[model samples]
Target chain A: MEFSSKLLQNAVHEMSQLPGIGKRTALRLVLHLLKQPEERTEHLSNALVKLKSEVNFCKKCHNISDTELCEICASTKRDGTVVCVVEDIRDVMAIENTSQYNGLYHVLGGKISPMEGVGPQDLNITSLVQRVKEGTIKELIFALSSTMEGDTTNFYIYRQLEGTEVATSTIARGISVGDELEYADEVTLGRSILNRVPFESSIKAT
Target chain B: MEFSSKLLQNAVHEMSQLPGIGKRTALRLVLHLLKQPEERTEHLSNALVKLKSEVNFCKKCHNISDTELCEICASTKRDGTVVCVVEDIRDVMAIENTSQYNGLYHVLGGKISPMEGVGPQDLNITSLVQRVKEGTIKELIFALSSTMEGDTTNFYIYRQLEGTEVATSTIARGISVGDELEYADEVTLGRSILNRVPFESSIKAT
Candidate 1:
């Protein structure tokens, strides 16, 4: 779409570079910014610049941090011995919200997806394996989504830990707690049945 | 949700302040930027900052422009005697895309809405009135949306121009060109019937 102002065009062009935003949405957002107080735009610009320039990845786990080491990796309260693996910081935030897992996280950044030209080497797998071989961690939990890429990455990492004594396990897949069994996809329902636990084991979880 | 990094949290907060964006979507957008080259984030930040600081409004039409007058107002080919009053620059661009309206535009910045605490004084209506009183514009067309706020703004402007010699009209409201009568909304279909023009006039619009 044509823009009346070159500045507006440039701003929309840059905003539309984002994954899901289209040109029309970008124009709407830029125009919205123009309508708001000038300080709002300044704040957004400053926050992004500051994040890009100063944001750091954890030296130990690869999660984004303000300092050299992320908070989780630096904390003594969290269990560093059991690192829950995830795709990115969003997953880290999601798992953190549940408050169920007290263990630390190892952010792989992304799963291996051949379709997207991302391989094991493109992720943070090397650092993860190195951390595992350094020998303090006792258990590693694969908490990535249950997509094909997730399974592939899990298998690749498991094979890499062949000689190491670290026990690796994946997060369970089942129908949501409040969802009906009939509404569950066939594959998930079948897997839930095959992976059913003893009655007392299910009771222990609560 | 808790964030491991303060910088990430700050960026997400500012990003989510935009209309239609939520915390979850903001997090996803921010993380996407983090995964890309650092220059991508820098470009986006710089573009927004530049637009906020340097963007200018045309002195005549109030449409966004790089110079004193907008391209439409400055052009001799455009019919300066017939000015279209619109809600904002988005409407200007939409009408420009049609290539049907050759007149200049006067953007009102926003429509009058009591629910949003907006009024005529908050818009560019005063400048528009001053322009009409100058007597160069022979006709004024109201092209705002068909919302209650749009109609209120249009009527408010019409009242302001009551003593002026300029003939005033509104953009037509009717079913879309390809829309079937049965599928059209009752109000629009009714308006189309009530405002029916000569058959030759309808053929000329095509």
Candidate 2:
């Protein structure tokens, strides 16, 4: 009498376990998928199965790739002497899409989080240190989020690479566009003033 | 060498085609699926395929079911003399969840919409009229949304059954709970007053 199949309910429950999806939203998505052609859902299923079967981490950067080395690490035009360290493979793709950074990337797999029981030993920091010890990299850039755990992880990495002779730098943090001064918190205001740089080509507000 | 697997990318793209899901959210969901065990995604895929294959519309009321005649239509306990008409199967499910009505149902499949190229012919109106003409149904209740198209469709059905002896009525529309007089629209305010009944208790403000 009920429209809900046990198998369908099981699937919806599994999907709702993912981040940002509620039970109602999961049901909506499952129903939408049900209305689609059989091949569409099958494609997603095959993809899920093939992801682990066909893909592996690049030996050099630890990013998910089909080859031994990822495209960025394998490219000759990239600056191998400068490495941009990120928290995940998604970050690497984001920076690559901007076409602003031509340096090789090293994914830390995840940021250090003591609350979540994830420590430095859980990350690919050992491989990063090994790569730095080889003495090929001239600079290491940290492009992590400005969260507490991200900052703590950055500090830990800095301490590890302090005496290695590799110049370390973090991305510039400041107020974003269309932000209000009154709404800006004290921490953001202090950081903005502390990192203030010279303004060139100044124009009057209309 | 691409950061995303081709299969994952295609699945994300297909999922993004559904209502309310964009590329970024789709990618996030696909990544979450990738992190889970293979059985989880397999279950979802199988459920989607099963949903389409295992369910069909009832021959009598057009309600969704695993058999030719939906459970509601085949139930001897349900009143066949009274039929509640609705726009879709979801509405039938919604009403069933309330467990307040013991009458039968008639699903219109969709309402009349000229702009969207839908008309009276697009619905199962012919069968509804035939059912009414069979002299079995004594009462017909219109349980549709209070939208322009819903009103138009309701009017059309009423006109079609004008000569029939069966009693016709529409569900009362009124202001929802916690109504603010200042914010109440004219249509809702007028409806609340027009459909006003004897108050059993005094209003208590929380």
Candidate 3:
């Protein structure tokens, strides 16, 4: 193929390694870069190069940050008494987008999967226990997925903080979303029935 | 979002700016990068930064190259007397993959689209005319598309080289591919029939 330059060809090859991008798409992107002002490509390249060099993990919550601590961990307005545990940074983004909770987060990096050879030792469980040992945290929320590995990880963390004052809770999976009572799955319906709340406010919207 | 590091966010943001990539896809790509060693991200970043800085256009044919001339232009075995003009570098790769043509190529970068405000001046047409005037080229093949803009660009170039000794030609378009004779459009079928070669030559396998 008659590439305009060796550097362009090399860039296309590198880009083609990405998921869903073929040689043609890569070439198109390179050609587009050629048409754009040099600054745009420079911006992207600088960002990429500085990504690992300038950025570091927040020592407290594992969120990305320019400094030692993430904004959430460094903020006094956030509830430090409540800790929401998750499997990865993506879950933190999901929770943040909802804007429902104002508590802190603990990213485990991954869930426990015995078959995959990843156990509690491979996760950030020790650091989490050290947080609970500080004695100010009241509730430990397990916002993990309902998958088997996620459940296993949740149970492991629950057992670790069993004797502590931190009362553990998990996100309920019943009545989810837009489904009516009749349309709910049997397992979900059963879970909802078992975890039913006591009547305090009128359901008829008085 | 709880990112592993600040670089992760920056990388994802840059990736998301590409033509079709979205936030989630960018995040996925960044996450994949994090899983690999430092060299992977560094390699890609270096390639991107060096793409424009290290490469320039081939002065003679306008193809991409590290030197003043591209591989096709530099190759001694390729047909220097014939020039195939195309809309973009992707077309160069497509034709090269066929291994059927050994002629040189000229990349126009784009077709002349009045709606997009692209004119002849914006393209590499002047260089093409200069090349024709040099008197080394014989066949000037217009391998551009059959669309209105493509046709207009071809006609414009044809007019520009009117007095030159070079013989201008357009690539044939007919009932493309596996199209049945019954379903073929009138224009295509008529052209195919009118341009049909002698049965004796095509009957024997090449």
Candidate 4:
């Protein structure tokens, strides 16, 4: 798209470089910023700059943090023996929101997607294996999504801990809590049946 | 959503302030930036800040420009007697792409929408009326969208220039160039029929 001003064009071009944002969307967003108070743009730019320069990744879990070790890894209340493995900080946040697990988290940073040229080594897999081998974590729960890439990542990590003391488990696959049983995918329904737990245990957990 | 880091939250919040971006998309974009080289973030932030600080609006037409007068307004080859009144620079670019209009443009900045608390006073209507009253412009083509707000803004400007010598007209409303007539909306089809141009003129123009 033709822009009247070089400055506007530059800003839109930079914005469009983001994933899922096209040139038209970038122009719309940049124009919206121009229509707003100057401080709005300042705040946005300043925040991005500050975050990029100052934010830290936890040395222990690789989660985004304000310090060397993230809060969950450093907290005394969270169970260090059980570590929930996730794709990124977003997953960490999602699991934290459910209030279901009080275990610590290990951020894989990304999945093993060969189609995108992202292999096991491209993520934080080595550090995770090192942590598990250190004998601190007793159980490793696979909380990645149910995509093929997610499964490959899980199996890769599970194989890495072949002779280790850490027990490996995956999050349940089933119909959603409020979804109709008929609408469940065949693979998920079959897995749910095969992995069925005791009725009393499910009742107690609920 | 809960964030593991305060800096991450602040950055996401600022990113989400842009129009049409929500918290999830903001987080995704921010995370994508984090995953990219630090220079990517630096470039994006710097471009936005530079654009906000240094961008200028053409003094004559209010179109975004690097100089006091935009290229269209400064060009002597263009017809100063005819000005196309539009909502903003986007419309100006759209019209310029058509390569049909060789006249100057007067940007209104926005439309008259009471629901959004935007009235004629909030727009660039006053200077436009003053420009027409100066007796330089002979005709104004209303190139604003055909929305209710666009029509209201057009009528508002038309009333403001009541005693002026300028003749006013609107862009045509009809089936798009390649659109099937059977699928055309009733309002636009009826208007196209009522304002039909001579078959000979249409053939010659095509």
Return the top candidate by TM-score.
1
User: What residue runs in model 1 are displaced by over 4 Å at the alpha carbon?
Assistant: none
Kindly list the per-residue Cα lDDT of model 4 for residues B16-63, writing each as its tens digit. Answer: 999899999999999999999999999999999999989899988999
Ranking by lDDT: 4, 1, 3, 2
Q: How far off is each candidate at the interface, as Cα RMSD in Å?
A: 1.0, 3.6, 2.9, 0.7
TM-score of chain A of each: 0.96, 0.89, 0.79, 0.96
> Residue by residue across A1-206, what tens digits does model 3's lDDT show?
54656688789998888777788778777778767787778877777767756667779877667779888899999999999999888888899888879999998888999898898998889999999999989998999998899999999998888778888899877886567999887988999889876566425423
For residues A43-153, write the lDDT of model 1, one tens digit per residue.
998898888888889989999988898888888899878999999888888888887899988989899999999999899999999999999999999999889999999
How many residue pairs clash in each candidate at the backbone level?
0, 0, 6, 0
- Candidate 3 regions off by >4 Å? A1-5, A19-22, A113-119, A174-176, A179-206, B1-10, B174-206
Cα RMSD to the true fold for all candidates:
1.4, 4.0, 4.1, 1.8
Task: Supply fnat for every model shown.
Answer: 0.87, 0.33, 0.69, 0.90
Question: Tens digit of lDDT per residue, candidate 2, span A1-206?
Answer: 23523555565776677678887777677766665687766665666557645667889998877778877788999999999999987888898887878899999988999998899998999999999999999999999888998999999998998779999988777776589978988888889889876665223311
Go through the candidates in order and give each one's C-alpha lDDT. 0.92, 0.80, 0.83, 0.93
Model 1, residue pairs in steric clash? none
Best by lDDT: 4
Judged by lDDT against the true structure, how good is candidate 2?
Answer: 0.80
CAPRI class of candidate 2: acceptable
